[model samples]
Target chain A: MAGTWIFVEQRDGNIRKVTYEMLSEAKKFGDEVAAVVFGKGVEALAPEFAKYGADKVYVVEDDVFANYNTGAYVAQMVAMINEFKPNAVLFAHTFNGRDFGSRLAQKLQLGLATDAIAVELSAGKGLFTRAIYAGKALAKVEVAGEPVLGTIRPGVCEVGDVSGAGAVVKPAVAATAADVYQTVKSFVPTVSARPELTEADVVVSGGRGCKGPDGIKLVEQLADLLGAAVGGSRASIDSGWLGHELQVGQTGKVVNPNLYVAAGISGAIQHLAGMSSSKFIAAINTDTEAPIFNVSDFGVVADLFKVIPTLVSELKK
Target chain B: MKVLVCVKQTFDTEAKIELKDGKIADAGINLIINPYDEVAVEGAIQLKEKGVAKEIVVVAAGSDKAMDAIRTALAMGADRGVLVQQDTAADEFARAVALADAIKAENPDIVLAGHVAADDGSSQVPTRVAEILGFPHINVITSIEVAGGKATCSSEADGGTQVTEVSLPAVISSQVSWNEPRYPSMKGIMAAKKKPVATVAAAAADNKVKIVEFSMPPAKAAGIKIEDEPEVCATKLAEWMKNTVKVELK
Candidate 1:
């Protein structure tokens, strides 16, 4: 019987939503699903995993695991994989997940697929589908080696509740301090009530045509009105009009939301690769010739400064 | 300190991608240094200008055309270049293995690369290489400061910036905000021709992952276009959202 493992990512003991999504997806493979949670005070979150089809929960709690240190996390993960001997491992394609997942694949000499939108078992092997060429194309990949590793893009898979055996297993791995070669000096979290760009169902994005920070504020205002996430194109990011975390492009976060609104954004191919998969796309641009209109479900040719304020008022009414 | 920067040649960001027979059609396509890698190169150059580095070496694994990108790096002030000639079919794992072998030979104090290749969008090769070499890596670094054999960096995370400090001999993948790259001047271009770019055969490495097939995403169908006054367009959009998209509006 195949065994599947999900790396349950958490911060300050709060489990990330993607972990539940991965757990739910892993159960569909008809394999015994186990969740590996590594952080101080994470054992309390095991019941949450069990609610999402995790048959067993492995907890590695230590002070060194309090922060995200690459060496520490990879070492523990490698140890866990070796002991569990799972045929497949899944992770969320977040900053920490991508970093640790890629390293784990190398350390174990296993096949890895990152940012996968879908995964299926074919011929007794895991097949992954991921976007390539800046979202212009999709590639189906087959992992050749054992212990297939894949990172699922956030918000791609649906989260479901499937109860499983609420068994907890504490794997006896060496309790050594994480061999951190780096130090995390500090972190400045963005204070916002809006949804995360990658996880939001509705996203409102702006581009160079936003002109400046004031224009981005308008975009934010609309997002606030709709209770949506705010994102920016590469041009806006490069111009320092938005934070890097808000960038949505080929090189940035790939978001597939229920609704995507592009305001003052002339769609570059790089930008299109990130949001083209969104269910409903609406483009607002002054330039009629902007390439974004080609793929938008609704196109409005007008000044965004005038259009956005009017839209906000209309939504209010 | 010696710095090694890994760069890749990719299609221009604005170029329209066309696929023919399940493969990218690259004929007559304009290729430039990957934008993020250019930022990495600029980071290395800034370190050199700050007297933190004795030399900077730029490396890539690609065909002869990739040499142009290496020369571009040299013109932008890299000391030398190395090209690992390999087939384009190599997956990210194989490429990372080949690059790790080459990087181990150089033994530089620090290694730099882009967070992700715009063409493939895998964002795995550099991290894989770092793991293979047993080196700690930090990705999406927005800014870096080197002093006293330790580097302090600010990297982008989900809705936050992580300030990290790592010792020398580590690998860092740069984000777009790291630094602005300089263009090649006439003198720099002429000098770049004189700089040595050594070509070596890529090491034979097994591909752990293979792409079985490639196809373009389904084309989005044409939608409604409204060229009217702002108020009318706004009302139309609101109505469409309420009726068609059915999104929750508070």
Candidate 2:
């Protein structure tokens, strides 16, 4: 029972890619790596977890899990943790995951590290590293005399394929649904054909220099051309030119993409903290002294409006 | 309805980090209300202005300096304030316990806090308080409306927004830009001085997550800047992206 458990997050019955990444990483740190998934119509996904090295897939299928509810999910997870008594329980650092992860830790009276970018095995315990000061510094975290519980940040771990024969285990959850305290009024899923901002390899963004919504459209065109995601600086978001979901900053979504192209954004410390970890950065702005150039691998100090079309056409080369 | 807003004082988002003896140097640093917590305060003020909320009580746990933030929130429209005196060195678990105890004494109808602390980046305290109080929580919320003893909230979720309704005595954490925070006018600032802010000792709670040390990330190297014509720059950039970066450009 002292194995590792990774909470699998799913949307529309499709397993989020981050789950596979976490499961694959968990294999190296635990004797047995298992994935616990809660949702309706997810039994077919148990086999998919095996490909990522999960020895067993713990499935909790019910109508109450049709969508994420804090009360319903936390109650079931507490029961499972108590029954299995796993040494390590990892959760994806998504919205729902972060919300309930702390709750579970409190209910179980365990210690937890939030948004850990890396984890290692320390005497069969977890050594978690997370960012603090809005990514200005790194904090090495250890929960003293407690089981390792943490929310794993996305885009850091490598995906592994141990090829374990996925054994599906539908553990009997003694927790009843009567404790649920929420009612879903409506769930308007954001419908966008573009790749998700966090998972996309390329993310093109604009800032205050975009001046208005029209400039962001050009940035979107470039993102669409590259099959990338569109994002904006806090300045652009504050102007109401873009939705909060598309904001990339300390207070918004932290993205670690392969290529991040920033147009017109004078890289503030807040904006850089979110995308500074990007593998390769390119910036286009008129100011040669712009801070964005410090982190960019490539820089073009020219008018973004003048350069975007030419860059688009040249990429068409 | 009684509203409780949990606030935290953090370094100004624009402040430069300086480490002395492996700890952040607080001297000469400008401290302000966390931008996200300010959003929570603003959300509460809006609810009161709409006639939906009757009174708002702001609370914080820290050294006496935190009283400044509580005063700021009061000026913005909190009815009264409570300061739970404690060293801020404690982890989210300890902080949540202290805040929850203070909250229990009041037994508010609703609780609001920032989704995450701007300093530790731990998005835990608010939801942890929700658990300690046995209240349902909806976090990372962009908008929240309360009526008929229920809170309707729009939260930012994985793929999109999820609108949920939780009964009274629930927890809600506000996201940045949910609403523009108001400045403390001179008149409001004067009023805040007259407002009663009580101080209470924090109940002892254990520190679960201890930080071994803090180190600044390595500074990025200076990069090459091409200030040539648009056409030439574009051509060179496209070559670098394809050949150097190896990004598959469609």
Clashing pairs in 2: none
Retained true contacts (fraction), each candidate = 0.81, 0.82
How far residue B248's Cα lies from its native spot in candidate 1, in Å, is 2.5
lDDT of 1 by residue, B53-154 (tens): 899999999899999999999999999999999887788888998898899999999999999998888889989999888887888999988988888999
Give the range where candidate 1 chain A is weakest over 10 consecutive residues by summed lDDT.
A171-180
Docking model 2 quality class: medium
> What is the lDDT for B204 in model 1?
94
- Fnat of model 2, as a fraction: 0.82
Q: Which ten residues in a row have the lowest lDDT in candidate 1 chain B?
A: B241-250
Q: Weakest 10 consecutive residues, lDDT, candidate 2 chain B?
A: B215-224
lDDT of 1 by residue, A150-269 (tens): 898988888886978858888765546648777899988778899889989899999988999999999999998888999999889989898778889877788999899999999988
